[model samples]
Target: MMKLSMLCCPLLLALPLLAQAIDAGPASPQQQETEGWLLLQSRNLAASPQPQTATPTERELALQRWLKKYRYEIPDFYDPDAGGKVEVKK
Candidate 1:
């Protein structure tokens, strides 16, 4: 009984590690944001490769507004207009 318990203990401890080993592959930006708080759980239900468009959360929207208004002279990704596609409506 002691031997059986020891063997089972190792298998149980390894179970979560084995789960993490499965290839989730690459995740897209949209898939990274989700209704669930955890991205990992959401990614499991997400259709891979193709990304679904996700609406920005309130906090994200606020951050974008702040960056656009107070970015000073810094350029590139921090400057939304650098992409020539960001249209932030006032």
Candidate 2:
């Protein structure tokens, strides 16, 4: 019983590493499509500013609104050129 338990422990420890290896494949077509969509949305949001006198909070709010609108198809990272870290809320 003790020998069997020791053997199983090694197998268990290797399982997670094996799983990670399998997960590390090239991006699929679907992933590419989604990333493209996110880049577009981020760019659009960054380009269009709020009203001339809008406060920083308002601008961030506006961006968040757009993000929520496109959350489903958008990736976590947006295009930097569109606007990187313009108004990040803690």
TM-score per prediction, in order, is: 0.24, 0.36
Model 1 backbone overlap count: 0
Worst 10 residues of 1 by lDDT: 28-37
- How accurate locally, in lDDT, is each candidate? 0.70, 0.79
Off by over 4 Å in 1: 21-90
- Report the C-alpha lDDT of model 2 over 1-90, residue by residue, as the tens digit: 999999999999999888644465337989878887788898775455655588999999999998887756765888778655578789
Which residue pairs clash in candidate 2?
A: none
Model 2: which ten-residue window has the lowest total lDDT? Answer: 18-27
- Tell me how many clashing residue pairs each candidate has: 0, 0
Q: In model 2, what lDDT does residue 38 have?
A: 85
Cα error of candidate 1 at position 50, Å: 32
